[model samples]
Target: MAGFWLGPRAAMRGYRLFGYDSIGSTSSEAMASARRGDAGDVWFAALQQTEGRGRRGRVWESPSGNLAASLLIVHEGDAASVATLGFVAGIALQEALSGNLPASALRIGVDGADGLTGQGHAARLALKWPNDVIADGGKLAGILLEAQGLPDGRMAIVIGFGVNIVAAPTGLPYPATCLHALGTPVSAEAVFAALADAWVDAFELWAGGRGVADVLARWRRHAAGLGSEVAISHDGQVVRGIFETIDEFGRLIVRDGARGTIAITAGDVHFGATATSGRT
Candidate 1:
């Protein structure tokens, strides 16, 4: 199998790729390259990850044939602004998956929390807060961001993406699904090709923080749990409210009626009536 294939946009932008049949971690490779003073704008991809990691250092099961990749870029911005990359990644990834999936399998419903059997479609392709892509309320893909300040005063940001194509891991907090489960046999290469192009457009729209509103508008279009019951777990506190909106800065905004509106910078969000049962 080929190591990597760059999309038209990626090629035009001079982005490089290092594809591996199997590897430890794409994100780890990106970090090592940055430390070696390699310029950014490169992608690290692999067919399998023997020691992959998820958010909060959880074990990311990267079996063979799954899509595990990372991008190393020189992103210069304040800490707050840099954090928005996660949102950008989410929108881009969702777009990529949308392009690769059949329209019939996707429907705008709950994020697939407790199974959307009655409230219309079960769950469509949606973006979860922070950095998760869901289909039918099960986690389809995830994004992880890490930043390192270089000695040259530049910031190297590595954005990692893991998509469940042929298979989805088991025993997760929430449910999990893959392309095959949705009746699609898409390959990792195909997914990466679409993602390479989608990310370019999304990133350009972000415009280094100048076009946040535009970027967020696209995100809201496919966001789940809007106007529904939402429970956010943050910093040892559980906050319940209605899913209001995401602010321009990418904060999850929840309205709790009596407590008014709350802006959440980080937390685990559960929506719909099954929100109360979304415990690990």
Candidate 2:
């Protein structure tokens, strides 16, 4: 297959693009590049990944024809604030996919979730809290962010994402769906093109984390499972409560019935009656 190419939209944004037919993981490449004193703002896309991983080191199946990409961002900021980029990535991915598929084809309903209603195209694409894109109540895509300190006193964040375009995984913890299965078949290259453009817009709006308030506001508009019962598991403990809202620093606010509003920094969130599924 031909290598992936960035169109004018992505090129105009000053993103250094790299494409591969197969690799261990795009995020791994970005991290290695950062360690070698390379300047950031680079995007790595691969047709297949041999050793991709998800949150908590779960295996990420990246068969040929899926979208496995990662962006290397070198930012000078406190670790707490830089992590908010995950929210920015979620919004960018949503917009990228929504731009390619029709509005009617993107809407997914979550059982027993209020505030799930949306208007127009924005309503169809929903953000599942911190790092997921939900369609038809199933997972369409996921975002994984990893950061490491550089020798030059800077931090490099590798924003990795895997989107099921032509196929979805089977026998997973939760239901998985792909773009083609959802009636919006598209090429991995086309999706990457849109994603690059959207990433530029989202990064600019983030303004070095100064504009996170705006990012969070926009994210809430596409939020899924808001005002619904949910469970979050972290480090072997599970917290179940009402899915409240995202806090100022982008932490998930869960209104535990007994614990009262708990601010969750990292965990796998499960919604509705399936709160015990332990799926992220």
Candidate 3:
């Protein structure tokens, strides 16, 4: 795994990586490194996490076989663009896993849509609003973006992701699944390797949000429940409406019966009939 990142392809792009058998959390470690003025393009991976968490401080269960990884970038772009990187990460992750999964395990939509009609290989994977990946109508992966100002007058953006490669957590608020359960049992190491390369490509495509239109279009192509009824919880209130489209700036656009179009920047989204417990 180290050799893959240290090779010319990754080294030329200034990629550095570290791995741990067990750690508190990959995101926490990356944030600490950034505060110490470490150069960016660093990837941290852990076999297990003792203090892992997801959106809104929800517990993130990282067992022995799942993929817990985070990437730190010293960003100098606008805050809006930096926030959009979460979407970029989501797209990269979906593309990476799709390439590695078997063809038989890939399908366009949860309703059995044909593959060729969607976004090529990415068709099988769906990007649930802000930064969640869905497979087989269940949660497959989650992304969390944490940012803080650096002393050098730049922003440190840590993009953390947890993928269910070997197993998924049980007794969650909503349906959870893993690659193994979906007929594509892969190792955490393999997923991390693919993710690193995919991230580089995705970052280049994002071009510091200059190409956000393209990114948003690609994400919408694989978005789940875009035209279906869904609910979003924010600030202790729940807004139930039709899932419209994501705006140009990466906010969730919902069409409410009384309020017309509403853009939600942060919230816990729930689809039809799904139990709403925490943010996905």
Which residue pairs collide, candidate 2? Answer: 108-136
Tally clashes: model 2. 1
TM-score of each: 0.92, 0.92, 0.89
Where does the lowest 10-residue lDDT sum fall in candidate 3? 108-117
lDDT, candidate 2, residue 25? 96
Off by over 4 Å in 3: 1-9, 105-123, 275-280
Give the total clashing residue pairs for model 1: 3
lDDT of 2 by residue, 175-245 (tens): 67788888887898889988998998898889998999999998887887787788888898988888889
Full-model lDDT for every candidate: 0.84, 0.84, 0.80
Count clashing residue pairs per candidate.
3, 1, 0
lDDT by residue for model 1 (1-280), tens? 5557989998898889989989999999999999999999899988899999988898899899999999999876887778888888988998899887775654534443322222455336778887888887778899999999999888999999999999999886667888888888988988998898888999999899888888888887778777778888877888887888899889889888898999998878877755656551
> In model 2, where do residues sit more than 4 Å from their true spots?
105-122, 276-280
TM-score: which is higher, 2 or 3? Answer: 2
Q: Which 10 consecutive positions of candidate 2 have the poorest summed lDDT?
A: 112-121
